[model samples]
Structure formats: structure tokens, C-alpha cells
Target: TFLDAVSRARPEIGDYPFTTIHPNVGVVQTKDGRSFILADLPGLIEGASTGKGLGHQFLKHIERCRVILHVIDMGSSEGRDPLEDYEIINNELKDYQMRLLERPQIVVANKMDLDNAKENLERFKKKYPDVEVFETTTIIHEGLDPVLRKAADLLATTPTFPIMDDEGTESSVLYTFEEKRPEIEVTQVEDHVWQVTGTKIERVFNINKLNTEEDFYLFADRMRYMGIDAALREAGCMDGDTVQLCGFEFEFIEN
Candidate 1:
């Protein structure tokens, strides 16, 4: 049983160059009221064992995970053979952590609704007979509930560990709210309009709908206070230029 089966997990906060250390960890809460962290480590590549790509960083994050959800793009739109892609990732993980090779990994076949996905799935199964795969179409929202339930069940039975481990030292699980300072990268796209992106800004926009003047003001104030105004000025954004959020666009002006 896997407790959390997500296609893509990014850092809570990010800078110009993303790194192995995450700003904030992802958490999944089950019906029984238990919560488990879904840590997003760097992805494993073909030569990750030999310090290729971010393989070492990616393997370290899985060390604390009870189960591994190997998410694969089954559509083959990325222009690589699906089975080879899976094998490359699997080999990298094996090279980085031999113990991880023994851990239960659920093959999450994503992009199932694509035109060529079924053929790739068939090929994948033929090559890896022992793997258990779950199909999902993220865009259409199909085959998601069952995956969630399976993830919860797996987490319930999995053992836990400290995020930062000490050699041969036993530790216990505990929740700590050590506040993480947010890292946002703001680029000036035009005069008075700053192109802003980061986990903090996105989450704030997701939870706050600017239907009212007050909401819009709150959002504006946040941007100004976060030094987005300075970034916009540096980018030469004019007062009337258009700026955008999640999906909504707004005109730039001094409040």
C-alpha cells in the first residue's frame, strides 16, 4: 500500500538553481488521521550511480521513505523508450542505494490517456514482469482515488525515520515547525511588471481568490512587502503593464 502517489513533487521554495535540500517537505494525511511526509528528492538518471545528474541527491531522499512510487511518463512524448527510461532510473537507484533495490517500489504508469500510452504500458509489463503498476490520467482526473487509498494503506504499514540520520543511531518520529525562510525568484518581464514564481506565491494565490477589492489589496500588499516591487522596477515594468498570477492577469500600479 502506498500512502501518497503523486506524479510531480517540487520544492516548497526554490531559487535560480534548484538543489538537493528541500525548503519544505510534502505531507499526506490519511482518513485515520495519520500524516506522512512525501519528500521530493532529485530524480535518478542513467548514470546517477557515477555522480551523473542528481542521482545521489534523489536516492538520499528515498532513504526516509517507506515506499517508492516510481512515476513514469507512459505516453512516450518525451522521445525516449519507456522501458529504457524505467530501467535507467531503476539502475541509478540501485547503484546509489543497494538497500533501496530491496525496498518495495510501485510502478506508477502515468499519462495513461495519451494515444500511445497503452502500447508503452504493454511493453513495460513485458520487460518487467514482476513490477506492479498503477495507471493514471492526471489531466482527466481518472484512476486517482484508488491510488490515494493504496498510498494511505502503504504508509500505515511503513516504518518511519528522522529526516537527517546519524550513523547507527536510533531515532523517533516527531513534528517540528521550524519555520523555513521562503526563497522566491522574481524576474522582470517588462516595465513595472515582474515575473514572479515560487512555491510560496503559488500556494498563497491558490488559497486566496481575489474576487474582492480587499483580497486584491492583500495580495498586492504581500507582493510589495516581499520586495516584488523592487524586482519589478529593476525589470523596467511600466505602471500600466499587465502582470499575471495563477491564471488571472492584473495591471501594474502603485497602491
Candidate 2:
């Protein structure tokens, strides 16, 4: 219904740009003539914490939002329980980051025109007694005025939150260092052949795309700095041994 809102706000606009690659941003003008930047972020789903269905990318954007307008399908036209849907989405949000639950949220119980929508809404109200819900049916644009007004009012008082990695903020420095864990693994596949595996090593290997001799030397230098060279020697790897790392096999030359 974001597209509907946009079209009504600006009649000249023909269509909403729909894509998952990036967010759709538009200026939403309120009845009081105050405009707010409304971003239509990609829909999140269950298991978003472990990189499921847009994952951290979607949740990361939500961190910047001061007020979260949770649009729920009250009709449950897709056969899923509306309450369960709400819980699932909220759980995903909470699981991804506890701070997300702290955002001031206004639930928009949408599709009120559909059958059993009212009944489902009643159930939803009972489930979440304290949650503020705005009833709406975007098809007829009913109840949207109040929702937008409430959102704008809330936004007026709400402060903009910094993104997750806002290094300039004082809160970023409040960190506790823990014992570092082993990030790379070295194993002997054969007498003169060794295999190296780890997220950090593999990521560096893939990102560097060691296609040229210079690139390979740079990668080797990084590995040495990371102590992977010492690790290979400690693991019983000898000079001229074949070391397999991230699918790339190279001869080890001890210095």
C-alpha cells in the first residue's frame, strides 16, 4: 500500500519502483504540509537472523528508522494466522537484534474490507493488548489518514537513530574484548599436501581474486601477517609442499 499512498500524494507519479536490490524512497507529505522521507524497505521473513530472506540487509535498514510502521495482513488471505504472522515477524526482528524491539512501533492492521478481518483483528487485540493498531483497508484508503497523522506525530517526537556501525557515536566505544578464537585451520591432506580452511582466509582468498602474480604475493604477505605461514610450519608442512586454500593450490616456499 506504500505505492497507493505515493500515488495519492503525488498524482503525477505513475508507478512505484519495485525491487529487492534497493529501498524505494519517497517524500510523504502529511495533511499539515510537513513532509517525511518514507522508505519502502524489503519485506522481512522468519529466520532473518541467520541470513534468511534478505536477512541482515533488511534489518539493518530498520535500525535507522525511529518509528516502525508494522503493516499486518489482518485478513490472513494467504491462510496464515495473522497473530502468528505478527509474532513471527516480531520474533525475527528481536532475534536479529534486541535493540530493534525498542523502536516505537505502530501496527497497521490492514485488509479490514476482507471477510473475517474484523474477527482476526479482535483476536490480535486480545493477544497484544498494549500495542497501538490502526485499522486500514488500502483498497478504499479508509483509516489511512489517522495512521499517517499518528506516524507523523510520533516522528515529530522521535529522534533519528544511528545506523548499526556509526563509529562517531560514543556508544560504539563501549565494547568488551574477549579472548580471540582460532580463525584459521591447517590440516595435512597428504605427506606433502596441506589444506587450509577458515571463514577469514576463504573470504580474503575470494575477495582478492588472486589472478596475477602480484596479487598472489600480496595474498601471501597477508597470510604471513596473519601467521598462517607459521601455522603451516607448526602443522608439519615442509618447503615445496602443495597447500590448498579456498580451492587454490600453490607450492609453499619457506623463507
Candidate 3:
């Protein structure tokens, strides 16, 4: 009752091209016949916690991964600072989900062929003496077997889910999608001019870049066409009313 999925592809699917990177999520059955889910999350950078650079997206993918494999670019010729990069990514992961801090971690020092990599590995070992590490160079297929073997061994030992207390029950949270219509308040600002504000209108304004007359007209048209005009009209907005966004105020002339 044991199985394994092997991929000989240069880079596994759904991964960004080049720089020896791959993102994968799959179930692995151990030699002992136990199965568990695993995820290969993308390396993160500083400001990832704030969703600065696909950090939030990447973090969300690993939310279900009980274990983490942090692969570092050991060679780092293109100015990829490993230590700081490691710290920044870890911080982002911790920030996104606190539970990730408790997950078991392993570090993979990749690209050991470069001269700087040996020096960096020495520094990394000295700094993080306790971290389990595996060095590999994908170009020549060197040191990969040991790394894969260790990963498989670690996975075999790691549990699928966090151990729960005897008395602790799961969360009583239930989610449902109920399409509720937007509640707009009809406020008479001065005269026939009414302020039309809601999540629907605000979201439309956010994505619309009014760089040209055509774009501006398109924005207005979208707002009006999305029944926003009808709602405003029903809310007592006259044809000659003044419409004000967060900063820019426009004359609400229905053409």
C-alpha cells in the first residue's frame, strides 16, 4: 500500500521559470504506507508580509503544509543575499500565519558549486548550528540523492496534522455565501446633489485609472452602467447633482 510520484521535468509545473525554483503540492506515500500532504512554497522577500511581492499569495499556499522546506540559493551570484533573504521570508511566513512558526523546518543549501557557496555554508552552519541542512547543485545532480533521501525520511516521521488536546474541539465557525444587496444611504448633501457611496462604487473607482478622457468616460460609464446611476437617481440624485469621489468631485450630468 505504498506509492511514489516521480517527475523528471526540469522544473515542476506551476513554477516560475529559471533560477532553480519549483512550486509543487502533492501527496506522498511513505515506504511505511502512511500518506501526507506536502507543499513547495516559493521563496519570499522582505515586505512579503504586507503582500508587497506575491508574498501573501505564496504564504496562503503553505497554510496547509504541515512541514516546510526552505531552499536557499547558496551560489547567489546575482546578489541574492541568503541570510537576510532567509530571515525576511521566515518573518513573512510567521506574520501571515502564526501556526507556521510551530511547523518543523529544514533548510536546503542549493548551488554548492560556486566558491562563495562553501564560505556561505560555513557561515550559515556557524550561525544556525541546529538547523537540519542539505546541500545540492541541480546543474550537475550532485548531493541531490542525500537531500531527497533526508526529505523522504523526514516526511515519513512528520505527522499529517497537529495533535489536538483531549478536550479541545474544532472551531464552531461556518461559512455561507449569501448574496446580500448593498445598502446605500440616501444623504441630501446640499440640494438635489446626493452622495452615492458603497463598496460597489469604491471598488470600481479603485481599479479604474483615469489617465485619458476615454478611460475617464469608461470609468463613469461603468459606474452608471452598473446600476449605480439608477440607485443614485432613486436615492434622489438629480441630473445636475455634483458627484464627489474621495478626492475628485465631478458634476453628475446624466448624458
Candidate 4:
């Protein structure tokens, strides 16, 4: 019902480019002159934490949100158990990021107009008694005002949290040493031709524009320092052999 809420708040929402596949953001102004921006994120499925089915993308957006509105379909119209759906979605959220569970959540029990919706909602409440739930049927736009008001009230009290924390202390100097790995791979493609390819080597080659001979020699010296020269020699690369790095080729000269 997030889309419904947005439509109600902004009647011109139809003219805007709105899609459910990506996050849809809209601003709502209450009768009391309070404004809140609501984000309608993509539906999360089971196994989202371990990069399952766009779960990471959906969960990443929730990290910045101070309040979460978990809209559940109370009516089992899609052949899904409302209680099971709630558990699955919550489990995914908790698994993806435990911190997400720490945020204040308002349960939106949608499709209340359905026959079995009220019964399902009661069961859901009995299971999660501490949770705050609001009922609404988006089709007729019923019971949305209370939900919006409650969300605004909760937002007032909720504080923003950082996505990540700094590792170093105020006075401490933290030196991180990334394990030195072979940046260039020397492979004898032919008798006198060697092919060099690796992520780091390609990035270095592109970033440093080696225009002059001094620059080229400096780049070659860097390659030597990185043990690329030694690697090529060990791989049976001879003097005058063509050493191909990325798209650039140079004749090898042994020191």
C-alpha cells in the first residue's frame, strides 16, 4: 500500500515515473503540517542475505531508513500463508543484516477487506504480540491516515545510524597491509610472445599515461619491482621477446 499512500498524498504521482522494480520515493504532508519522505522498496524474498534474488539490493536501501514499514498481505490471496510470509521476510532481513532488526518497524497488515484477512491478522498478532500493526486495504484507501501519522510520530523519535564504523581510533595510526599478490600473469602464448593479464596491472597501465621514454622506463621499473620481469624470465621469456601487457606490447630486454 506504499504506492497507494503515495498516490493519495500526491495526486500528480500518475504523471511521475514510478516503478516497483526500483525504489520509489515520495513526500507526504500530513494535516498537521508535518512532512515525511516515504520510500517503497522492492519486495524481498527468502535467501536474500547470501545474494539470493536481488535481496542484497533491497536490503541495502533499508540500511539508511530510520523506520521500516513491513507491509504484509493479510489475505492469503496469492496462496501464501500470511504468518509464514511474515516469518520468511523477517528472517531474510535479520539474516542479511542483524542491525536491520534493531530499527523500529511498523507492521502494515494490508488487504483487510478480504474475507480471511481479519482472522489472519489476529493470528499474526498472537504470534508477534509486541509488534505494532496497522490495518489497511489499499484498493479503497482505508485506514492509511493512522498508519502515516504513526510513522511520522515514530520518525520523530528515531535516530539515524551509520552504515559502517571507522576502524582506527582517534590517536592510533592504523596501517593496513594487503597481501602482495601477482598483479601480472606471464604466459607464453607463442615461442617468443608472452601475454600478461591481471586486474591490477591493467588498472596501472590505464591510469598512468606513459607518454615519454622516461615514463615508459619508470613503468617498466615498477613492473620489475613487482617481480613481473623475474616472472617472465622464469616462464622462459627471452631477450627481444614480445611481452604483451594489456593492449601494449614491448620487447623484453634482460637486465
Candidate 5:
């Protein structure tokens, strides 16, 4: 509901609670031509700093976010105090390895339509006088414009936090590739049965898999150019021998 209020990109909406397996993104462009991306990252429980309840799965995405819009249920619809929830989330951000609390954060008091929401909001304000919070009832699209504009303004000034410490910050590959395998391998698996195995052989077979004579000639010509015929003869493949390649059987012939 809040995501829809932010960008109006209406995705699936349900009342039941579910795990956010991955994040969803939406863009917001203010009237003054300033724009920023907002990601709906959920699943931050009490122990998110130590990787609990989809903690690491979601927190890793926070490293790149320059601003965090922490939405609190002021309505207490879930029977939890708003003040406690605020502290818990900020604590988790503080405990995270990336020092996430250092980023600019905008507090949101959501679900203002529910009962006791105003009372809880008063109590929350009394507890944290310095913190500025925007109130909203996302279900009905109430009190959303100020929040959107404020987020865009903050993004205009807030620089992105460095996710890595080393100089290899320019998209470096992580994995070391294995040594190259031969393109073609001609093996004598039996007395007269020769099995030709290789990635190129399989690719050729898969492409020219038709049973027509013209297709077979094109396939044989590709194999010849790749030196499979000479490799087979060197492996002691004789004329009239049964050659198997990618499960297709054909009799060998010496030209």
C-alpha cells in the first residue's frame, strides 16, 4: 500500500503477512525535476543485525541506499509500541556491519486511519522531539506528497555510501574461470564403436538435428572443418565403424 502511494505502481496487494524474498523497486520524480529510486525492503526483525528472519537477505540491499524511509505503524494495529519499533530498527542499523545509521533517514508514521493512531503518534513525538516524522494513511493515499518531496530533496544532497573498502569498486569479476577444455574429443570406447564427445560436437548435433540428407551433409561439413574426422582417424577409427555423437549413431567412412 505504501509503495503504491509512493510511485502508484500498483502490484499485488494482500492483507496477510508474507515474507519478502527479494526487494521491489520504484522511482519517484518530484515536480521540480528531482528523482530518486525507492526500494521496498521488508523483513527486519529484532535480530536483523545478526542475520535473523531474512535479515542478511534484505540488509545487504541497504548498503547502496543513501536514504532510508522508516515507516512505523502509528496505529499499533499489530499491538506493538511505535517508540520501541523505532529504537529496534535504528539499533539494528547501528549494529549492521556497514554503519547504515550514518545515512540520512526519514521517519514515517503510517496507518493513521486505524484506532489509537493519533494517541500513539503523540506519545512517539513526546519521546523523540528532535526527530521529524511524516504521517500517512497509505491505504487511502493520505499525507504522501510531503514525504515524497522530502525524500527527493534529501537524495539531492546525500552522497551514496561506499559499499567496499578496496580500490576494485568498478565492477570486478569474482570467480576464476577453469582451464579451457578441448573443443573435440574422439575416443575409442569399444572395438569398433567410436564415441565423439565435445561441447562443439554437441552444439552442432543440437543445431543440425534433422534427419534429412541435406542437414546431415551440412553437419558433416562442420565436423570436418573442426578437424573431427582427422582426430577420429588418429584415434584408430576404421572405416565402417559405428560413430556415436550426441546419441546420434552413424557409420564412419574414409574419404
Candidate 6:
């Protein structure tokens, strides 16, 4: 409902949990003619960072987000402690490999119209003294404008985080003299263990969400067309040699 107030992306609003099965991306325009993309990702339950509940799915959607609008149910409508909910989410983010906690965060004290909401908000404010909290009741569209404005303000100043991986992000850049460098690179991580990595490959892996044999074959076809197989051979890879791509390992084959 909050997203509906800011943008037209009226995702499934309900009283029960997990109304959003997939993410809904919407463009938000503030009053000052400024705009930004807002992604209404699925709710994160406990153990989300560990691939439990819609864990990785919800977390992955926020990778490109510059600011996180954390909405808390101040009324404890679901019988949860609002302050404890914040800590639980923060712990999940910290546990995730992406360092999600490092992003700029704005807290939204939602359900302000409900009883005990004001009391919960007071406790939250005291606990998170340095954090910015916005009082709001998303159902009626109250106090949502400030969130949009603040999000836009933060986006205008924050820089894009550097993309990297422990597996050969350095070798991904060959430092060639040509104007167009290779979009990908192959690195030998260890004996008979080759790693295919680059900015493009990582982005592709994140976007594709390959989960079946057909998807795997399609990705393999793409690698072949992109000369990844040839690069592996050039790097002294042989049949049955291990090739790692985005942490997944496979055996090289010579045809």
C-alpha cells in the first residue's frame, strides 16, 4: 500500500503474510521532478539469508538498491516485537554474503494508526538513536512523501558499490590496449581448476537464475558463442578439467 501511494505499482496487499510471491519494480517520482526505481520485493522471513523461506529470492532483489526503506509494523499486528524485528532483519543482512547492511537505510514506522504503535515507535527511536525513522500509516498514505523525498536525496549522493568476487575478479580485467576489452575472462584458480569470471558473467548469473538442465544448456551455449570454451583451452584446460563459473563447478569437454 505504501508503494501504491508513491507509485502505481499496486502489488498484492493483504493481511496475511507473504502476499508478494515475486518482485514488483516501479518508478517513483518525487514532487521536485526527481525520480527513482523502487522494487517491492517479497517479504523476508526468518533465515532468509540462509536460503530458507523466500530467503535468497527476496535478498537478491535488493542488490542494486541504493537505499533500503525498511518498514516495520509498529503495531506488532502479527504479534511480533517491532524492535526485535529490526534486529532480526539486520542480522540476516549481515549474515548474507553481499554485505546488505552496508547500504543506506531509512526506517519506516508503519501502522502508526494502530494502538501501541506510538509506544513501539518511541522504543525504536531510543534503541536506534542514529537511525532516521519516519512515522507512517501506509494504509491511508500518511507520511509516505517524506520517504520518497529522502530516498531521492540519498540516491543523488551515493555512489555505486564496486562489483567483485573472490574468484578472479582481478584477472577479469586484462588491461588491454584495445578500446573494447573482453566482457569476460578465464582464470586458473588452481591445478586443473579454471574459473570463468567477469563483471558481465556475474551480472548474467544474478539475472538469469538458472535452475534446470535446459537453463544450464542455454548458459553453456552462450559461453560457447562468447568463446569462453576456447579461452579455457588457450589457458591450458583439458578434457575432464574442473571449470568453475560463479561458484558452480563443471568438467571441461573437448569435442
- Which tens-of-lDDT digit does each residue in 114-184 have in candidate 3? 98999888888888898878887766666655555656777667666533323545668879795764544
Cα error, residue 135 of model 2, in Å, equals: 0.5
Q: Name the runs in model 6 displaced over 4 angstroms.
A: 12-21, 167-255
| Total backbone clashes of candidate 6, pairs 3 or more residues apart or in separate chains | 0
The best candidate by TM-score is 6
What TM-score, computed on C-alpha atoms, does each candidate reach? 0.53, 0.59, 0.52, 0.59, 0.60, 0.61
TM-score of 6: 0.61
- Tens-digit lDDT string for candidate 2 (1-255): 554564343212111110011345567777777777776665555566665423665677788788888888899765558898789888988887737888788899989999999999999889789988999988887888787788889899987665664444474454768565447989897677677777677667556643344555576678888888899889998876766664334567765
TM-score-best of 3 and 6: 6
- The sequence of per-residue lDDT tens digits that candidate 5 reaches over residues 1-255 is 577677855454222111111256788766677777888765365676775423564577889898999999999775667889799888888887586888889999999999899999999989899999999998887888889899988887898788854543476677878676566888787677677767777666556534344545666677778888888889998876766665334567776
Residue 60's lDDT within candidate 2 is: 76
**What would the per-residue lDDT of candidate 1 be over residues 1-255, giving only the tens digit for each residue?**
121244333432222111122213566654555555665443444565764323454466577677776778899764557888788878776776546766567678888888999999998888878877889876676676555667777776766644554566576896869456355656655444445556677666567544344555676667777776666666676665655443233456644
Error of 2 at 195 (Å): 34
CA RMSD, predictions in order: 12.2, 15.3, 15.9, 17.6, 20.6, 15.0
Deviation in Å, model 6, residue 55 alpha carbon: 1.3
lDDT of 4: 0.71
The models' CA-based lDDT, in order, is: 0.60, 0.70, 0.59, 0.71, 0.73, 0.72
Candidate 5 weakest lDDT stretch, 10 residues: 13-22
- In model 1, what lDDT does residue 249 have? 38
Show the lowest summed lDDT stretch of 10 residues, model 4. 11-20
Superposition-based RMSD of candidate 6 using all C-alpha atoms, in angstroms: 15.0
Question: Which stretches of candidate 1 lie above 4 Å from their native place?
Answer: 1-24, 30-34, 161-255
Candidate 3 displacement at residue 89 in angstroms? 1.4
Off by over 4 Å in 2: 6-22, 165-255
